[model samples]
Target chain A: MPGMDMMDMSLMQACMDACAACEQACTVCSTQMMDCGPACMNCADMCNTMMRSMMRMQGMTPATMMAMLDATVAMCQYAMDKCMEHADHSEICRMCAQACKDCMDACAAMRESMMKMAS
Target chain B: MPGMDMMDMSLMQACMDACAACEQACTVCSTQMMDCGPACMNCADMCNTMMRSMMRMQGMTPATMMAMLDATVAMCQYAMDKCMEHADHSEICRMCAQACKDCMDACAAMRESMMKMAS
Candidate 1:
């Protein structure tokens, strides 16, 4: 929480909301039994982890926060890439991809703010 | 599900129970504000993801299952290592470390059975 005191609560709230929405979208998309299912499952887990970590700030160090954020970004990128492959034909995939993008952007913004606060 | 028809439901059930238990333990331990908190947080997410993925096998491939198992193992190992450092001082850390070990073993067994069934 050392670097998080200056973090805007609204941004954190938005990030958590995006993460939760992305998890739900990915869960539904994974149930479609598409090739993106595995990526969606992975992304959902990462997003949930990111959300819960944000909720429990006392449990994190700046190092761990950055690591978790990096992992989440990677997972979101992978999931979004996979979903985009089928986005043209599947509405669920399209929605999931959008959710992943939103979550990724939120997380990136959070990370950027943390870095700025640290510096 | 192609290779899962022969999976022992009892073993799968036991592994899922272990994962759920580990997740709970880790979540509680993380609130202790120890150095292990971050690791515990990561492990909790991985365990929950593992449990849910098992429940929804229709959403997974053998490759994804193996990847998830591997990630769970790594997370459990990391969390257990961190918690063990404080096990001598905190009952919660001790219990959490034990839960992580149990979950890791169960996941490994599940992966082993999956391999045998595949062969």
Candidate 2:
């Protein structure tokens, strides 16, 4: 609260929505097969976590924030790779990959805004 | 995959472990009351996400990673505050606050490590 003067409710809301949607998409995607299931499950949980975290921004410092973003981006990347392995054969994988990408983008945007504000 | 050889599995594992422990603590904490319930729910979800994301490190940029960390730290702060409000009277809240503090510290360490590696 002390260092967060730039908390944009609208942007944060949209990002959270995207994260929730991505989590759902990835959850459905991961249940498709064992190959991608582990990563998808991980990503789905992470995205959901990320969304809920954003919804409650009353306490945070830049260090903790960046770490979480780093983890999220890593997860999305892993999920994307796994989903692509099945994208050519599965509509669900394709959609899941897209969702991962979207979540990554949204998280990045949110991070950037926070960084600028904090700085 | 291209952007993630800096991942130290041991450190990541430790951080994830801490996250899991914090998640479980917060989940248990949240069931204690209506006062801290909402924030506890949010924190528990965020910690789980943060932990899972760390486990999957194939896709991440420093930027995305930072955003997530920021979100997580913020979440922990909120959770701690909520827990503290009940800490005087509730043992669970006191324990939950400790978990949040530990998570915040672990995530910070991990973030710093990643930042140094990325740089």
Candidate 3:
């Protein structure tokens, strides 16, 4: 429930950047109409939501932040798993998988930092 | 990969409509700086993605559709949970919660219809 005053801006910014990249990658991958398309679309939406939540910390509590992070991680993982299936044949899927991995890691780091700050 | 030829257009259209309504309501509620803001924002993104995916069913498989529906349902449930906490004091939250509920129901129905058709 703390304001931005208690949060690390750099970490938040990095997470947002990662989310944006992942969203873009997923969006492009979705257009390929592969079996991963729906997962890609889901990941894109989740990443965008995660990015915007960080931007609007005034509207979030630690609880909501944790929930969003968990959901983002889940969606990213699902997307990445699907993309990895065709990664060898599809350049876009490979890129999307990497982006999802990066975004998941960034979100996890953000969550850890928030926990440490709260404690 | 059965084309939209086999889909119930009316059900898909209704689901898309619900998703759009939910997205708009959540977007509006998220700007209110309420504790539900993060969840509302997340719901908005998910709803938009769901609507768009329906519009572009060419890119989706039944498996992906089921996964997306699950994700959308989870998000809508979370958002509705958060909004209910402040519904008595916030009209926007109340409306957003209703929209989320409607979208969730619509998505569930669509999923059920898809299952029946597949069978």
Each prediction's TM-score against the native?
0.64, 0.68, 0.64
Judge candidate 3 against the unseen true structure and give its global Cα lDDT, from 0 to 1.
Answer: 0.82
Report the lDDT tens digits of candidate 2 across residue range A1-119.
Answer: 45666667677787788789888998898677657777788778877766765766733445555556666767787788778988898999999999988888877877788888877
Over 4 Å off, model 1:
A1-43, A50-89, A95-119
**Which lDDT tens digits does candidate 1 get at residues B4-114?**
789878888988999999999999998998888878987898788778878866545565576567667767877888899999999999999999999999989998988
Q: Write the per-residue lDDT of candidate 2 for residues B1-119, one digit (tens) a residue.
A: 34667666777787788789888988898787657776777778887776766666633445555556666667778788878988888988899899888887777777788788888
Q: Interface RMSD, all models, one decimal each? A: 4.8, 5.1, 4.6
Judged by DockQ cut-offs, is candidate 2 incorrect, acceptable, medium or high?
acceptable
Alpha-carbon error at B79 in model 1, in Å?
Answer: 0.9
RMSD (Cα, Å) for all candidates, in order, is: 6.1, 4.7, 5.5
| Candidate 2 vs candidate 3, DockQ winner | 2
DockQ for model 2?
0.31
| Whole-model lDDT, model 2 | 0.75
Question: What is the lDDT of every predicted structure here?
Answer: 0.83, 0.75, 0.82
DockQ of each: 0.17, 0.31, 0.21
Clashing pairs counted in every model: 0, 19, 0
lDDT of 3 by residue, B9-57 (tens): 8988999999999999999998998788877887787788778778766
